[model samples]
Target: MLSTLQPLLGLGVILGLAWLASERRRAVSLRLVLAGLALQIGLALLLLKLPFAQAVFLSMTDLVLAVQRATQAGTELVFGFLGGGAAPFETRYPQNSFVLAFQALPLILVMSALSALLFYWRVLPLLVHGFAWLLRRTMGTGGALGLGAAANVFVGMTEAPLLIRPYLAGLSRSALFALMTCGMATVAGTVMVLYAGILSDTVPNAMGHILTASLISAPAALMIAGVLVPEHPDAADRAIVAIPSTSRSSMDAITRGTLDAIPLWLNILAMLIVMVALVSLVNQMLGLLPTVAGEPLTAQRLLGWVMAPVAWLIGIPWSEAQVAGSLMGIKTILNELIAYLELAGTASAELSERSRLIMTYALCGFANLGSLGIMIGGLGAMAPERRDEIVALGLKSILAGTMATLSTGAVVALIL
Candidate 1:
């Protein structure tokens, strides 16, 4: 019974944390908060527990796999053996031959191009509108805020705001916070397949879980944002916004998408190199310190100590909390890509299946410092007059975003 009740405890704690961070505590709508939590729980049960929903998401994994294969085709043609092509020389350790930059990272390019093509064809807009409608009806979000939140599920944070570009200047503090929180709390579709590929060996139906995490986190984000910056009763905006496609044609969409992905691809590649090197350097410097429990005091260990309680609060078992916490810390401090890579590197024995599942949801967000800068820069460009306000709310959104993903983990823990 104690074990069964732990998740409920965690869920309450997660909600309480958001409540504590609320800017106007008295103004928070009990109805909206409860509705958002119910929606999150309901969606989790529908997507994760129902057999038909499971089958649908499982089927979607095949498309992810297909994209991987197609990406490999392009990579192989461009990079030859470096990109998973037939090598002239035999390697003593075949398992170590997979080059992440050449093989796995290319999936981002493929996914971006495919998403662009779908958007141009109006396929993605239909899905976005459906989700927007659901948010509008259930959460009482305005048209622009709901659409921006929904778009974040399919596109990057900066790109999501573009869908509601005209209304950025006029959005209320609460609505703007909701948009930023949703974007940071959820992962974009462009890198979803790449993440699935990385975790395929570790998590069952990896693509499905990643997709579901993003979907569920949307409501969680809005919920937390509403709490952090409660909308004034008289200030609510309920106008319905139209979804616009910027692509002129299918081919143009693909080309633009591919071009858009180049900078992101480079950014990811550079981040991996720099972050890994910096961590190694820090660890080497810390090696001079006295060992803790006969273990070297390194960055991961430090992070683990800091975030262990948070991991446990999300229903990760104590035994595995340190490792899980370290991943959470890496994700928050560095980025989710690094966190996922670290998770992939960890052995199964170190983290139980349940702990891994919880972490998958917990770590599936763009709430790191790097992304905060990107959000400010992108949104700032759109509304220069409100740049100061954007900056002020930016830091708080990180906390709100982190709480959003953690709340999803808590709900998953409750039902799993």
Candidate 2:
């Protein structure tokens, strides 16, 4: 009884706080808060607590594990002899240091190739179309907007634009915003694997939680984006957004997807390399800052301080709020990948259960600066005419996307 009632109490608190913050816009604020609560229960029952859902969730984990294992064969074949036979979970040891997120960045190329092959084989398009169908019906969106949003859940922001290539010129401003926000708000299927590997040990069901966060946030993204900047007049007036392209052939898909994954893989590699270097530099520079007691303030420390208020706003306990705030800041400014990496690096067993659960949902999406650039570039490329609109809307979209993820966090906080 207490376990069940605790979530409801949390929900009530979140709704009350959000309502107070937007007291002037009480009606809209209340609705958004309620929508978040609804999502929390829906996800908890259907995806987290249900047996069939658990089965499906585990399948994703297995599928990811297989892909990671198979794709890393070359690396493993060469290096496995040195330490491959070691404990499978040894990767969790901070001392192991070498992470597969960078190690398997190349698989982006492989998966892209596979995606292309699936497109060519017509399998990918059908999967995309089917999901698009759900979005259209569930969100009252046109086929094009639905496909674009669904694509973001699976592919990178830029790659997702390819699915709606033909319809870009026809979309209304609102639909276009939804498309970009979706990209900013969800992880691609490929990196989903990377995060799964990163947090699998620490969080037993990390994959399921990450997948659920992405899926639930789709509608939340649409809701927030539409509110931020209403859909273009033309789009609101249209019956359906047009779908783009016939399915590609298998051979052509393999060739194309591999080519497509190149930039994605490089981006991943570059992000990790640059971010790691940057963090190291920051640590060194912070060494000179005034020491508090024996420890000088650092970026993570400052971010923790700045975000602690926001973390509390989300209803995390005061003791853990600073840590949660730091996670939120890292995820927004840099990327969730780093946030998860750091979260896992911490002695999480020492963290309160509520903090662990909240971080799980909070760091679950792609709501970061990198993804903003991603949405701008991806959508801009799709409809060069809308380049200005995409750029102008970037900040607003980021705010909405951030809120969309928070809406998910708010939901998770309730359930926790």
Candidate 3:
């Protein structure tokens, strides 16, 4: 079926684009990337179908859901009277379109506070420890670095670095590359609620799967980041050192987390404004193009045409490949948030279940250009010396990040 071919199609298009991004089509580098993808595909199959791996996957999925459920308790406590998970406020006002829990800004706020509390209580780090242990053993990463990389799935990108803060200054180039790529590849805890809100109508389990994608991609990111630039000198002999926890109290933790989350909230709002405007501008320009039949297609559609092969490779049915590939391309170039809004319009009861799951995983990542900047800003603030290096690696990180998310989608696609 064409749906099956989409994955191969997507891989070819994306890799071709990546090589073009490098501004030269080097055959050797292309071969290396092809080899890397082969390794990624192999690892994905082994992890997904293996009995022991599936057992671990199940336990991890349960743990993520349990955290989500516990986190929801806080949102309910404060807003239940206002219908946190109850019917939309529209039921009360009749004219209001907003559904508080499903709209989800408040949940982001509540989860941010509670995520901090969880960190203060060390509840999450223990969970991170178990998952990171798997990464260290299976993927050949140093334990301390692996811990930070894995922890990013449940925490903020910048915050994760603090877990391995002691080892960062000393991390080999590859570990540092893996570290930076992981930041760009995984979505943070704060936005998980926001995205769940965005995709609520189409797929209800967006949060859980987003969480799962982040976890699965963490090690995938390590593998790819390591491949691109092998650790200068592998930190093989170095022992993994844990960073000391730094919250004075739960209240203090909540306060600091809220402060950290403000930019995230603002960025989401700002990105929505600029990206929507730019998309409209692009669409308008493309509308001037000569028509093929009787209708003029927009630039987004042009992108859909250019990138359609990728959508197919990721398991999108041939019928939807043009549209689906465009959406995936939009998510990578723009942000997942915009792609989700676009997906909301695209998703309907009519979409196939397999297509639906692929969409969910495809939209799960921090691979957009804006995130590359966020990595620069966040990591730059921590180590001013690494700003140039961060900036230099920015584009490659987006590619690695996209590959990481696709790698997750590939696994989920196989399962479907």
Candidate 4:
């Protein structure tokens, strides 16, 4: 019974923290909060439990695998043997690092261009609008904020704001918080494929999990954002906003998206190199410290110690809590991509299947320090007047987003 109740306990603890930190405790809506929690619980059950739903969602993994194959074809043609695949004179099993850089990362470019085409075709906007409409009706979020939040499921944090650019200035504090939290709480669809590729073998229904994470995180973010900063009366507008797509034609959309991805692709490569190198250097320096537990104290162990409770709080088994916590810590300090890579590197026998599932949910967001900088820069550019408010709320939004993901983990624990 105690074990069965842990998830409920975890949910209570997370909500308590949000409530304590709320700007106006009296303004938090219990009805909407319960509604959001119900939505998360229902989604988890449908996507992971029901046979038909599971099959439908899990099929996404095959689709992503198909995308990977397509990406491989392009990479093989351009880079030849070094780009992976069964090309002549190349090793059949290439190094993952090489494949990740040359083969997998290129998928981002493909996905971006594809996303633009979808937008140009009006499919993306229609889908985003449906989700946004649901949020507005259920949660009473303003149209602009709901659209932006829902758009994060498909686009990057920076680019999602473009969907509601005209209303950025007029958004209420709570709505703004929800917008930022949603952005930080979920990643773009472009990178989702990349991360899914890394963990495909390790986690069953990997792409399904990624999709569910983003989908469920939308409400979880709004719930947390509402608690942290309640919506103001002036900010509650029922006017629906149109989804804006920036392209003249299908060809133009593809061209623009490919160009847009250039900087993002480069940034990912640079951050991977720089951050990985820096972490290695830091570990090396820490390795110089006196030995503890008969082995040298390293960054991983330290992070594990720092975040172990969080791992446990999110329903990871105590036996595997530290390892799980270390992943969360890495995600918080660095980024989810690095954390997922480390997870993918872990021997299957070391972390139990349940723990791996919990960690996957926990580490699904883009709430690290690196992302905070990106959010500030991107959102700041869109609304220069509110740059200071954006800066002030940056750190808090990260915490809110983290809580949002953790809440998802807790819900997963309850049902899974």
Candidate 5:
């Protein structure tokens, strides 16, 4: 049936597009691509299909939900009714009382602090090292690149590179591109909880999927980066890079982590306000244009038209591709936060359960224009000598990251 073949077609089309965009098409290693795909698919099956692994991830999701509840405790004390406290007056609609900024977003700060404390206690380093060991042994990546890739699964783009700071100066061109690409392709742990909170109403076990998406996307990013900029045989640097400890004490780690999260918290708050208002203004302006098929043309319609084919290629049914495409467009143009927020809203009601799951994997990354700027600014500071090179590769990283996530969606579609 066409439905059964759609995932295969989607996977082929995605890889073919990446090949067409390759800077060195002849240098692309088919073996590396297959290995990466195998790893991604294997992980998805182990974690999502196996009963024991499913139970483990489900337990992790419960822990994440517990963290959200814990965060609400702090928000309630600080923001009262606006922060999920008892309402002074009973309202007709109980669900409508949820305030995203005060109730859900605060989870980022709590998770940030906990992650830092765990890192300080050397808990996270062990896990990062375990994952890095797998990457190095399987993918033959250098110590620095492997560690950086693993770290990106749990930290921000700039923060992940800091794990391999000593080697950043000496990295080969291909390794550098791989590092940047992985960063853009993975979401930080700090915001993963927040994203899960946003989609909890729509997606079951959202935290587990967000975590799995980032874990699988790392290899996909490396794979795509290899296609786009194939590594020279002599370019591999296998130096053993150890994870550095930056915190002085547990208390210090929490303080530094909370302080670091403030800027990100403020930035997200500002971006949502400005982006939503601007989108509304744009839609209003577009309302003046002539209707298309008896419907007014708006920004979402335009984006949906442009990206619907891509959505369909990722195995979303045509009946729902337009809405899924619109969410994809919003994620790329704005940020993943906005896209997840939209998915959590009434727009989600229009999508089938399968389409929603595919979109969840697709939109789970930091490949937007805003993140591109952040990566450039952060990576530029760390390796000023490679500033020009980083700037040049910035846009390519976004493309690589986007394709990496799309590849993940394709794989999920095939399995599901």
Candidate 6:
């Protein structure tokens, strides 16, 4: 009974927090908020439980796995032992020998190129528009905002706004906030396979869960954005935003996509190196502090204590809440990649199935501090006039995105 009730507790806490932070608290639409929550829960049930949908998602996961294996083959041929090929010299920690830069980062390049081909073929735009139409009809979001929000599921924050560049200058504050918040709440599909590769061993249907998180985050983001920045009655209506599949040719699409992915790849590689070393340095300093519970006080443990209530609110078991909290804190402070790598590294037997599921849902986002700068730069580049607004709302968007993903975990716990 307590288990069943915990998710409700989580739901209440999430809603209460959103309401408290609302710009015009009394004016927020309760009906629309409830509808958004229902949409998230319904999509999860359909994708995870229904026969046809489940099979379709599972097939996609199979395709992703195949792509991963293909990437590994290429990695082995090119880099040898560093890329998980047989090493010439024996090394300590053989598992660590498969460096992320060589094995996982290459997947980003492959996915970006493949996505470009799909876009050039008009397949991706068709899907993005269909999803955007649903958001407009169901949530009353403007066409420009709806399209931008849906596009974020497939592209990065910066790339998505480029799709609706003409409309950005005229978007209402509420709509702009929705666009930014959605960007933080979801990861681009180009990197979904990379994340799935990291969790292949521990999580069943890795691609399926990643896809579901992106889909579920759309409405969840809309709900939070609506509350945080309520639309003005006099706001301008957005023109029909075109979803263009632009490329000179198929070969051009491949080249352009591959080139576009380079910056992202470098960013990920540099961040992992610097952030991990910085964290290690901090932990070393923290180790000098007085012991707690007979264990030296460390950064992860400190985060665990600070974020434990949030973990428990999201239906994590009290016994494992500290571990779960630490993961959440890491995702927020550093980034989702580090958090997921840690989660993937943890002993499977230590965390229950329910706890693992909740953790996956909670950690699936791009809401860290680094992303805030990315969003500002991306959107600010598209609409220079609104640069100040973008910078001002940066922190608020992070909070909304964080709550959006947590709402997903809370809903999953309630239903399953």
Best model per lDDT: 5
lDDT of model number 6: 0.77
Model 3 stretches astray by more than 4 angstroms:
1-134, 236-303, 347-351
What local lDDT score does residue 91 receive in model 1, on the 0 to 100 scale? 84
Q: What is candidate 5's lDDT per residue for 315-380, written digit by digit as tens?
A: 899889888888988888778988999998967899988889889999989987667766776677
Against the reference, the lDDT scores of all candidates come to: 0.79, 0.63, 0.63, 0.77, 0.79, 0.77
Task: Work out the TM-score per prediction.
Answer: 0.74, 0.70, 0.64, 0.75, 0.74, 0.75
lDDT per residue (tens digit) for residues 1-416 in model 1:
65457667877887787788788899888878988899899989999987688567556556555666788899999999999899989888886887977986676576667777876786665555565566657886666788778767766686667555556787888998889999899987757887898999999988888888988899899999998899986555633344456889889988977786676566656645655567568879999999989998877668768888888887888888888888878887678988998888863459988888888999999987767766776677667788899889987888888888988988888888
User: What does candidate 2's lDDT look like per residue over 127-208, in tens digits?
Assistant: 5456556644444456667776765665666666665455667777777777778877777766776787888878777777
Candidate 4 has a TM-score of: 0.75
Clashing residue pairs found in predicted model 6: none
Off by over 4 Å in 4: 51-133, 238-301
By TM-score rank, best first, the candidates go 4, 6, 1, 5, 2, 3
* Model with the higher TM-score, candidate 2 or 3: 2
User: 175-197, model 6: which lDDT tens digit per residue?
Assistant: 89989999999887657877888
Per-residue error (Å), model 1, residue 304: 3.0
Residue range with the least summed lDDT across 10 consecutive positions in model 6: 236-245
Clashes of each: 0, 7, 7, 0, 0, 0
Candidate 5 regions with alpha-carbon error over 4 angstroms: 54-136, 238-303
